[model samples]
Target: MTRKTVRIAMNGVTGRMGYRQHLVRSILALREQGGLDLGDGTVLWPEPVLVGRREHALRELADRHGLDQANVSTDVDAVLADDSIDIFFDAAMTSTREDLLKKAIAAGKHIYTEKPSATSLDGALELARLANAAGIKHGVVQDKIFLPGLLKLKRLIDGGFFGRILSVRGEFGYWVFEGDWQEAQRPSWNYRAEDGGGIVVDMFPHWEYVLHELFGRVKSVTALAATHIPQRWDEQSKPYDATADDAAYGIFELESGAIAQINSSWAVRVNRDELVEFQVDGTEGSAVAGLRNCRAQHRSATPKPVWNPDIPVTESFREQWQEVPDNGEFDNGFKVQWELFLRHVALDEPYHWDLLAGARGVQLAELGLKSSAEGRRYDVPELTL
Candidate 1:
């Protein structure tokens, strides 16, 4: 038996997302059971060559993880040039993604980068082409597909529980902290359009999975987007202009003749969760999954509509649903995808979450942007895998 180990390099591991995605998230996942739980070689762990601009941050990470001189550095090129490093993982901000990913592919390392893979449609397509041409494994972080709630829904759909699925309605939104007085926070880059930001691009990948998983591919989409909030304060108490779309309403048409409507927002009042809430209807049955519960209604007892708002209603339609239990522990969404990447590289396994899927997502955002700009419907391009 041959000894198995795949050396890996991380690019942009210093920024907020980089720190979480690369250092805390990916590093925790690479271990057997996370943090110092290095078992007796049960799972294949990749040695990391951390590359970032911040020396102090890198040094701190190295010290915290005991990486020291073994596999840590400030030079990205050095890490890419090393023959031992088999995988290149990128959790860099969206603006810096394309060039770095292309560089890694040129260096002949398998790649896993965060979405939207690139800010533009052509950029993502080109990256996919490069990865395909080079014959290196490439995957984008599509954490939503692996979500436990959605996974259960996938099983139900595959089991033919929802026959000839018709439409999907998704409501996903909540107010995110703008690093105001509380200074508690979300990534500021997300609210800034120039830095490759916005709710449409940031969250469409999640909708892509649910829509593609249940109905099929998207043929076209029409959207309306807005910049509801204009100013927000950063950590320094300096006000920054918000340029990205804060809220988006989109209608999707799947290739399989099904339709979908999605509402993604940053200014919505939280009545339910900000999570991806779904209501899927079909010929045989219907399923509804959200933060609090997952419910189903068969064709036998489909709604006929009772029209008395003042009347005493016994069976509340909303109260009929029951909570979906936690299928997996509360791991960061980043960590779930990170582990899959490790398995993909070390085990030589097939990872379904690829760059093409990410490109489709980019296309969706692009269409949303177009619809918002042109003030009309935009036909989504099919996934060019």
Candidate 2:
């Protein structure tokens, strides 16, 4: 019956993902719900102190959310130096995240951040080592694992739905409009390699964790990365060279002998039910999972079709799959993880997804890019602290 308030220093609220997912949907949403119940007769309340580079944007966000203006500051150092702040959360640009996280660890604050934890594998490992040495609770954002569709898929896996998983195929991405005619949906930096922008670096980290958590740890990767759009207009309506790869096609070998092929592109148009989808095939059954829905076809119900080039085919192939039911309410993936991290910090609860896991993700990305450049498959070496 007691309330415990934990102050969180929220950095990079000016960015799209930080503003929408981390701030509004996660932290503010929890605040509106009267905090999280800790199951120990204690309500873990979160108080957010906005930290960013722009004073105007911070003030505007605070005003929009009806938050106290006094809690918003452009000085991240001053915020991190505050002893009252229990956690420092970052959703900033990948280029600037490492230094900020290191400073937070030095300040003795629990740190949580978005991945690719650093621009390189070495930097990611350094963050992990520093956080462990500092004895502070640290975490990296692995939000997709907590998604509802993935949850249902995991349930099926646990229930022996997919006996002896065979392979996984994932398709993710959408066409980002060139900024000349229509303003690009994504920031200009996403297409510039100099600014820590590239489809391979941006998404390979996600694929690493997703494949590892669901199927198996990736053992090797053969990839081909391309910049489909060579030129694009920036936010200022000026043309610039798009040096980064906008699309990547990769084949991954998993430790469990399962093969995973994934295609990530920002130039392809959507042809699936969701923006992203994964089709997992096994010896006993197969399932396709999107961001919110999962459908499965068991061996018993699967239809057999004959290959014919001359005859008209009508098998109702899509109808063969049965929809997975949502037996429980599913919250936003970001919000769920926030609550878990809050519990871990407040009650010393166990959390296995730390900065080391993030380093593994970054390692996959680096290897993937290398594989693409060399036109050869590369083995994934095991990383240790």
Candidate 3:
């Protein structure tokens, strides 16, 4: 069996998502597993070259992660100029993604990046056009669909368990620290408007693809957003006015006549089973899917409750739902997608989650912000090549 080693230039590997999800959990894990089996007596190995702005931090991260220090560099332009790098993966700040991707495409490298490919819809679409014109393979991260709970939900939908899909309710969020009394978990840039920050820009893309892939395409959106926390402490303990919206309430109408209501907030306290949950109701059944768990109640098992405020009701409503079993072992969602992209690049396989799909995500985020600004419903236009 022949083994092909593909060198990947991974920028912004020092960031939280880049370091943990892309580098360690996905790439390093793939390397540890002896690369990916190509199902034809061949394997594809990924060699990640970590790139960042700081030399000291980059070297430290490389040493800590057991990566070759020689492979770590602070010079992005120099790395992009390297002909040996076949893929350019970005998990950098959203504002800088477009320029970086353009350079990568110019250097004749395939591209893969985290969601909200660009801050604006035009920029995202331009990136798609540029990549297509350059003839390089490209993709955007849509990790939520690969999640176990969502996969189970997809299975249920494919099996026609839900006779006629009606509505979807998504609850996502938790209280984020302001960095005054307690150290903030997220980066300070996430709360600043000058940077690409806001719950609408950050999460609406996720909602777009999830709604599109599971139920149907989102037709229109009516959204309300607010900066619930006005002031927040920065990384250096300096107070700064948070101009970005921390919470958003949106109502989306799907093409299939399904209504999806999503509430995204960083200020709300968690009262659900997971950090995020989606409860889907259909004519024949209802199911609630968390990050890792899913529970459903079919029409045969569903209980009809009669409203009687005069007396205490004695029905175990939550207990009536049945837990969905994990039929097989589930791998990390990010890792799964990474394998697929690698296969797509090496084997010339068909990959639907291309740059166009990423542009669609950015379009949703842009429209969502517009709806919030105008205080009116905005129709989502179809994105074409």
Candidate 4:
């Protein structure tokens, strides 16, 4: 079996999502597993060059992860200019991603990035056009679809268990500590509108792909957004006005005539089984999927509740649902997508999640914001490039 090493120029590995998900959990884990087998008796090995603005941070990260110090660099331009790097992956701050991707495309590097590829739909489409024109393979992360719970849900959908889908409801939120007392878990830039930070921009991309994959294309969106926490302390412990919307409530109309209501917030406290949960109600059954767990109830097993406002209900409503069994052990979602992208690049495999899909995500987010601004449902136009 022949083994080929694919050198990856990884930008923004120092950030939280970049460090943990992309670097530690995904790329490094793939390396530890002896790379990915291509089914054709060839193994594709991923060799990542960690790029960041801080030399000290990069050096420390490399040391902590047991990566070679020679692989760490502060000079992004120099790394992009390196002809040996076949792929350019970015998980950088959203505001700066477009320029970096443009440079990578110019350098003839294949592109892959975390969602909301660009803040604006136009910029995202431009990136797609450039990558397509340049004939470089490209992809955007749609990790949620590969999640174990969602996979189970997909299985149910394919099995005709749901019978005709009716609607999907998603609840996603967790309290984010304002930097006043406790140290904020998320970056300070997430709450600043000028920096391309907002719950709508950060999360609508996930919703877009999830809805499109499981249900259908989102036809229109009616949304309401707000900056619930007006003032917050920054990373430096100095007070600053939170200009971005911390929460967004959206109602989406699917092409299949299914209604999807998704609530995304950073200020709400968690009361559900997981940090995020999606409930799908169909004609024959209903299912709720969390991050790792999924439960369902068929029409036969569903309880018929009588309307009795004066009496206390004795039925165990939650216990009636049966847990969905794990048919097999599932890998990390991010790692799974990473492997697919690698295979797509190495084997010339068909990959649907490309720059155009990323642009669609951006389009949804832009239209969602427009819906909120106009206080009316905004039709989501299909993006073609």
Candidates in order, TM-scores: namely 0.88, 0.99, 0.99, 0.99
**Residue 242 accuracy (lDDT) in model 2:** 99
lDDT (C-alpha, whole model) for all candidates = 0.77, 0.94, 0.92, 0.94
Tens-digit lDDT string for candidate 4 (1-385): 8899999989999899998999999999998999899999988889989998999999998899888899989888999989899999999899999999999999999999998899999899999999999999999999999999999999999898989899999999999999899988898899999998999999999999999999989999999999999988988999999999999999999999999999999999999999999999999999999888999999899898999999999988999999999999999999999999998999889999999999989999999999899899999988788
- Which pairs clash in model 3? none
Deviation from native of the Cα of residue 260 in model 4, angstroms: 0.2
Error of 1 at 189 (Å): 1.9
The segments of candidate 1 whose C-alpha lies over 4 angstroms from its true place after superposition are: 1-3, 15-26, 34-43, 291-293, 301-305, 322-336
1 versus 3: better lDDT goes to: 3
For every candidate in turn, the CA RMSD to the true structure comes to 3.3, 0.9, 0.8, 0.8
lDDT tens per residue, model 3, 103-137: 99999999999988998988998999999999999
Which residue segments of model 3 deviate by more than 4 Å?
Answer: none
Q: Candidate 4: TM-score?
A: 0.99
Q: List the residue pairs that clash in candidate 1.
A: 220-380
List the pairs of residues colliding in candidate 2: none
Estimate, for each residue in 1-385, the C-alpha lDDT of model 1 and write its tens digit.
Answer: 2335667787777777777765666675556353222234544655677887777777788788777566667778888888888989887778888988988999999998878899898999899999999988888877766656666677678889888988988888877766666562566777899998898888776677668766788888888988888887766777899898888898988998888998998887777643667888899988877643466677876656678989787776765544445565645556767776766665556787888888888888888888889999878766674
Give candidate 2's TM-score: 0.99
